[model samples]
Target: MRRFASRGGIDTERGAPMSKTEDESGTNAQERGDGSSQSSVAAGRAFGKAVLRDARRGAALGAGALQRGGRLLWSRLAAKTTKSERRASPARSPAPRGPESGAPASPPFGRRRLRRLMGAALLSLPVIIALSAAMAHILLPNLEEMGARAEDRQVFEDAHGAPLIIRGAVPSAYAPLDTFPRHLVDAVIAIEDRRFFQHGGIDIEAIARALLRNIRSGGIAEGGSTLTQQLVKISYLAPERSLSRKLHEAILTRQLERRDSKEQILEAYLNSVYLGSGATGVPAAARIYFDSAPEDVTLAQSAALAAMIQAPSVVNPLADLEALRARGALVLDAMEAQGRIDADEAGQARDEMAALVPRPPAIRYGTWFSDWITRSAETLAPAPRGVSLLRTTLEPDLQVAAERIIEQHLAAAGSGAQAALVALRPDGAVAAMVGGRDYGESQFNRAVDALRQPGSTFKTIVYLAALAEGFEPGDRILDRQLDIDGYTPVNFDGRYRGEVTMLDAFAASLNAATVNMAMTVGLDRIAQTARTLGIDTELRQTPALALGASEIPLIEMTEAYGAIATGRIPFEAFGIRSASGMAGQDRIALNPVPGASGPQIDRIMAARQDMATLLRRVIDDGTGRRAALTQPAAGKTGTTQESRDALFIGWSGDLITGVWIGNDDNTPMDGVTGGGLPAQIWSEFMIVGLNLADATTVGGAKSLETTPAPAQCNVTACRRAYRSFDVSDCTFQPYSGPRKLCTR
Candidate 1:
């Protein structure tokens, strides 16, 4: 009844009807504008919408190009389809019949047509032959290069930074080209890829057979990839389990065969193949599982490696020895079928391999030293980024000795107690570094890490400072309790021995006397003295520091003690000498510095001389006397307040050692003093390191120059006595002198 746009609707621009129905009705209404202009407007609107739709489609297509290209390239690269299968089907050929039986002799086609067909077939034969020759000469090399690049390779090294001790890898005996055990290779080809040699790379018949087997099994029970195709996949492609990936692998395999020699391709495949247990190559795998070289590997071993390649992680010898053996036997069967080995050889190899001794748990013997050396080597001569080997100076003997000493002593001390020891040469080169008893169980290197109070060991530095202050060892000093400006310091026993000589005070570790001496020289001077002697630890500016209140690591302590033994020169502790990359089958030295880093001229040399004398007195008469067994040794015993930390530092002129015994948690032990376990460990390691040499050969106090002393305190003693010159009064004074006195 009511329509908005009726037959008389008009266009504002053209003043015309918008539709045919409107145009006819518009004659009676209005026609003041151009009807052609209205048609143009509608056509332009349609064109704009089409342009927008096309732009949207173009954007989407551009976005998907990269992903689609990648997929296409991958498929082309794989190309697993066989040319024979892709060829025209013979079944599609016309059926043949007996001569003149059911079909006409020539089927109405003239001899001329037949002749033309024959001529076409005859002409194609030469072309096909020529094309094959061109492929053999041109395309083959390119394919081989692709396959070679696809194979995998691995590199590694030893603790000494020696070249890799490869597993499944063929040895130098088979070097230049991998020469597999003839039997092993034969068996693999027979069981796994029978047409391996005959085919350029991909095996069509094998692939067809595998496809049938897989379909029957309803799963991937058999792989269709030929050895070459597998090599192509392993070497050049991501190991994705997709049909496209397999297709690319087949193409690459064909390309590889055409380009490379059979021997070269096969060798690369064998060498690069994974054999489980983190072993990427056959040589590495052989050594890992059988502790044998690749050439020396038996058929069973070869079979094992071969089987491992199928599913390395599943057939890993380290994880499942039985499965590995079973897989290996299968490999052997392949080798036997391939005529690579005789039945007898295979059987014997199988039995011998099965009887191989299982690998033992890793030693992890020098875990602490290994880790420390590893870090040190990194700093000394850092490897390139992504490098795995680190050169180090870790002597097996030193490691063994340090470990045995730690194990024996810690076990003897029981589990509750902890100890640290560092043995170094006089030049500061570390011989053995034992952080704790079981470095393997605990990785903390207490030798270089833990900081504990030095106790009496700190006394040596105080005395050295005193010596630098012109104090003589033989000079007399009062060890009795005395007030220093009203601040009285007592001995360890809280009792003072009256009027003892300086040597006696030091020998007895007289705390009051040492404090008095330190005060006389000034605390700052003593701290500076310790610093010069290689003690970089923080020192408290208190009188207690005179008796080792400051804590230091055992390595620093030994190194300082070693400097003292060196008689004034500070030597940095180092293990590695130098390292160089391999050249001509030998490692060359990178640097020729004969010594570790330290002060050039020892500023604290004289102090070290005095320390030697004082420490010798400690072993001869004081707390460390027990440390001297068969030779004259010099050492200092240290125990902190409440006996929370115990330390003993000693040297036999050849080796300087320091030992610390305390709980890692810093909880005090029951009656475990430095003179107990620490001293014993020091003694044990020192004896082994020293070799019972004559002590005189090393720098001893006997070589030190004796100093003249002031007898001011001595003269004070005779001041109270009767003097002839001071006798002003002529009183006999009881004449209590020795017989024949001046009174007569």
Candidate 2:
């Protein structure tokens, strides 16, 4: 009944009719070529020509031109066809719907095209899926596991190549990854890495959630880090909480994924992560927590340890056993949710954990050597890829003796004094090292880490330098009051011996004489000699360095002296001898490497002879006389300023040892001199360490300058028996050398 033009100017009603002028269809008279119609047709043809011309003009322009051109072209085409078609076609019912009607007409392609498309899709469904899966496998795969970094422990053996123990923060044996119980692996994976098998190291979903949480909290509030990232964090990076560290972890994890197989990564992560109770890695945790190995662990036990991976200290069995078990139950539930284990198995595991009570680990055998070995392994050998087998230079019995000596002597010395010792072969193989009196009391390694002044023992290096400078031990040097550059040095007695042969001065450890010697031989040269001899610790080139003012490490000091005792070819102070994987596949030989070329053998021997006299005098009648052993050994005693540090460094042909005794608090020790306790310890160690005959022939540096005791006579046996200061001494007058006789 009503009709109207809508927004688009289209008639809204179906039955609407237009006036004859609006219809645009020609009037019947015009079609019949009436005079008026003929004029209209000519006008229409002109209009068509004008539209065509406009379209051509528009087509020459850009984007706007294209739109205009298309619109003009369509309009022109429609004008030509609209009237002709309306008159020629039969009448048809109009569409029932309009713009107002929600039921719009079907797409022009309509139901037929849709049906064909559906049929094609149905027919090729399998093929499409197959190709998609193939592409996914080439790229992402179905959570295929890449390899993980292997956390291998270092194994240390005794001198005879027998395994002493595994040396690492964690002390545990290697167990094959695949052999680990399925439940154990499952529990670990469920708690530590739920999508372990699903993700390619980085989890975008978890990261997004973590980022959101972090933004909400205005700080790092959550970690979406995967197990692989955790491995990289603990192994190569510090545990600092930072965005950069997280980024590094993410990158390292991706690399690990690309380099390792999935099973390998999981195994490595499981083995290396710190679990709890002073343990590092899984095997260690197993031993420390359950007193069992990884493979032997039950399902409940596995879950219990797995729970600690997130907050080891919080769920620590040592601190909170119940919490540990409770967390373990949660792991089982997670597994059940993932259908990794049945509900029945989860319930059974829960019961098992409830019934079990783990005991606190009773740690045993805390030795400084073990601690040192643990740290040394970082450089001596690569972490074991499978199982580490290390051969060390340790003499087990000697190590025991060193430990016992420290303990026994420290107790006897009394008064909170601490002692450290280091013993090595002439070639620089460390045989025995004691870092402190008791490792249980403290883990500080005094032998290598401490930097106490060497006192007079430093004179050994000074004397060595002097020998290099063409000064003979028997050559006389003035020890009278001398001042150099506003600094004055005195003997231990605070008095100067006017003039003594270099031999006697060194033997007596006269501070003034030693400083004079150091001055005679350039301070720089002395420092250089110390370094060249194997002392890697920094040294001062000042004159005070002569009197041992610059602090140094005992191990390095011993190492330096060991080079001399071995006749001056440079060698490193080393403990590791060789290493191999448990399977014996990757063997790494850690043999000694020469440091630098040294003095010729003849020169070293000659210098040794000169110092040999000096070393003998000290043990004979000088400061170190109290340290005299029945064997032939030479050493110097050192007493620091204010008796703060006392040291004795001595050697035979086979070994060199350094002993230090002092108050850890640096309080004076009842005027303890290096000759006292240090010398005594050195003597005691050598007695057990060397054969009696070998000891006698040890310090032959100056053997040519001294004659052997006459087997037939003392100064007495020649005429009548008489005694010298030495009860066992068979004294003859001083002899020049092997061919020269003693002159009275």
Candidate 3:
């Protein structure tokens, strides 16, 4: 012991020996009358010398090891060399003593020494892996502290910008970790990471077990990722399976563990982890699987959902019931093994979870409208990267009203029927559109997709052509059976009104009179008029076209009438208000400037004022009498043959609404006419819910009557002018104006 102390440079009788430099500095301090400072300085100097001596000895040992490693490496390289290369080694060549040979090479390590060195290297491998893992964690970026953020969730809203729903990779609502039942958290931790709280981000024991299992299975059947590693994998690293990604995930996991507590990590993981079926987080998963809130999730349901964390698609409760129950059993076993639940409790929980099955999520109303906005938004810009806002023209009140009316009407009518209602401003901004009775039942937007014939409602187009062709409002025509080219046309009542004025014929929807006018003015002219009004689809030029035989979409028909309601350029229907994100910025203009070139609706209505009068009379006393409001409401009613389709499209003030009701299979309703059910529904929607007072008449007032064409030479006023014409052959009277034919 005395010899060992002396070698360590400490005196046995006293303490550590004073160094020469400390002895000199202490004498100088004593000379300045600071004896206490001298002794402290002497002790510090001796301790530093001892530390330096130990460091020098460590350096010598490290150098010796390095030399040994070099010899072994050179010997291995020489062993691998070819015979010709081996001849160049010093062992195979003659010694050279010339000064040009810079220095002598160390001899290669003997085979025994090489084996010893290899044994030392093998023994140090585990230590090397441990140190490397520690260094990797230390060098990792401070991601948890740096505050990285995921993309903001996009929100779908009502037309007026009220938030309706949120969509993304998942919909999430963060909650405190304690809010979940203990079994719920235990189930996740048990199956995913048995040693979650004990491990420092990565568990070597778990990894070893996983590797062994994978090797035995001859495939990657197990994943050893701890909870922290999974969090780092999904949040920070790319989802690709590669060495670099795994390295990055491991590094970020350690960094995450250092900065956040176990509870915080659990909260974040439970909030954003993808549990399957578009359930991004635990809250969304609970709601989607149970139709209940997160806090209300039952233990059995929670275990089933937790089992999905390992292989969500493979263990989908809805798709593979047996597989899901098996996974639930495994989770229960793990929980019991971890002492989180007693064996009896685990058995009872397993039995309960075995009976659990998937429940379809309850869909909220108005997703059709949201989907419509999504489709329209895709056209306006690229898909949203972050939150996107779609400003729509939908009125919640009117939408609710329309939905209620369809359900009531369908039940009362006692038929399996479908109805669509679309209401818009004169400028074409859609206000309310109930495309079907229940959007949850069907997403097919019938308002934009259905094409039905507008029976007498199309007569407006035929008569507009007649008014422009010099026929006055009083040009009487016979509403009797008429035949042309072997096709006879009759009135809806199948009875003849000998001769009725144009206004009376239109009010009663006298088919023969309307057909007579169509033949006289030409079918081509009527089609052109309908197209100009707003009907974009093809129109037939046959006489049947005059009787509303052409198939046109309901929206197109409503917009065509909208043109006549207000002369302004139609507002192209749009729902998206604005789109913005990390991608870029885009916005939609609310009111676009009207074009100056087209035939204006107000102008055309003003020119054909007599047509407006006829429509008003129809609503007042004719087929559309049921649609009359407190004010002068002008609209046309249309019912197809056998009442196959019923339509009531009209305008009050600048607001135009069109309603269509029929079976999807085109089965005729029991005596349902356009003027009966459709008109009443239109009245209910417009007056009861839409709340538009008759602010202005559909068209203001009647214009001056035009001079009748000279083809009508039956009246006494034109008898002298038509000297060679037979008055008895004419069916209508002539006009009393300065006739261009009379001038001859």
Greater lDDT among 1 and 3 belongs to: 3
Q: Order of all candidates by lDDT, from best down to worst? A: 2, 3, 1
lDDT values for all models: 0.61, 0.68, 0.66
Compute each candidate's TM-score over C-alphas: 0.58, 0.56, 0.55
Residues 25-45, candidate 1: write the lDDT tens digits: 355222535565455555644
- The candidate maximizing lDDT is 2
Count of steric clashes across candidates, in order:
30, 15, 2
RMSD of 1: 23.8
What's the true lDDT of residue 528 in model 1?
71
What is the Cα root-mean-square deviation between model 3 and the actual structure?
21.5
lDDT of 3 by residue, 562-670 (tens): 6555543232444544554313455434442242222223334444556667778889989999999886677899988888888888877445788888777787888
**TM-score, prediction 2:** 0.56
